[model samples]
Target: MRILYFAWLRERIGISSEEVETAAPTPAALVEELRAREPRYAAAFADTKAVRVAVDQEMRGWDADLAGAREVAFFPPMTGG
Candidate 1:
């Protein structure tokens, strides 16, 4: 699956996006796999509540299923003026 990071998430992870191979069933599970890879990934996913997720470009929760999904994106919550 392709994972995308935005805003400070991109800066923290040091990449905008990357293709990941995992056996995760849910978004939260995927995050756990990523957080185990390195300290950078750990830091990037440290706070789940502060982060927002999307499955195949549609916003969803961390518990969302990843089955047959092509893309997953992580970003901070948006604020409008």
Candidate 2:
């Protein structure tokens, strides 16, 4: 799956996006997989509460299923002034 990072997530992870190969069933599981990969990933996902997820461009919960999905994006929650 293609994983995308936005805002500070991109800054912390040092990349905008990347293709990841994983058997993770949910976004939460994917996060665990990434967090275990390296320090950068761990730091980037250290506070999941500050993050939001989108699966295939649709906003979803951390437990959202990833079956047959092509994209998963992580970003800070949006704010408007």
Q: Each candidate's lDDT (Cα)? A: 0.94, 0.98
Candidate 2: count the clashes: 0
Cα lDDT tens digits for candidate 2, 1-81: 999999999999999999999999999999999999999999999999999999999999999999999999999999999
How many collisions per candidate?
Answer: 0, 0
lDDT of 2: 0.98
State the local distance difference test value for candidate 1.
0.94
Model 1 over residues 16-69: C-alpha lDDT tens digits?
999999889999999999999999999999998999999999999889989999
Measured against the true structure, the TM-scores of the candidates, in listed sequence, are: 0.97, 0.99
Lowest summed lDDT over 10 consecutive residues: which window, candidate 2? 12-21
In model 1, what lDDT does residue 12 have? Answer: 92
